[model samples]
Target: MTVPVADDWRPRLSPGLVLRHDRARETDVLLMPERIVVLHGQASTVLELCDGTRTVPDIVAVLAARFPRAPVGDDVGVFLERTRKEGWTR
Candidate 1:
């Protein structure tokens, strides 16, 4: 079953999952058991903030500040929801 991400939700990487930079590939990666998911674009940035310390709005605020002209609120919401469904974030 899929759960909808709430504005107050504080998302974090699931157990046994780690985010890291792959210098060889010059890209970020999501490391999980027997799996290596290559992260692209703002994925790494979004995942990095999913440390369970900040709520969805808090994260969106930070990203919005960093990228003033971008639609961070909607983008972050969609991204978080997708990641949650993929079992990447909890």
Candidate 2:
């Protein structure tokens, strides 16, 4: 799959997948066909914003505002690329 560029890319979590937050374990997980992806904190935040309506840049902006101390764009971009490769987003 081609990695989506940040500008015109509107990302949505893959269909048939469910994001579950485990409070007791303090973890986030993605459930998909025969697969489970454990998500770290920043990954959870970024994926929550991938609602099919927001471009990558838009996501970066929101994250930037919410986390004024961290530079998150590059990390988000890398994560999105990995997700795209793994067929976790569209």
The C-alpha lDDT values of all candidates are 0.91, 0.85
- Cα TM-score of candidate 2: 0.88
Q: Model 1, residue 78: what's the lDDT?
A: 85
Q: How far out, in Å, is residue 47 in model 1?
A: 0.7
Model 1, 1-90: lDDT tens per residue?
333468789999999999999999999999999999999888999999999999999999999999999888778888889898899999
Model 1: residues >4 Å from true position, as ranges? 1-4
Candidate 2 yields a Cα-based lDDT of: 0.85
| TM-scores for candidates 1 onward, in order | 0.92, 0.88
Model 2 clash pairs?
Answer: none
- How much does each candidate deviate from the true structure in C-alpha RMSD? 3.0, 3.0
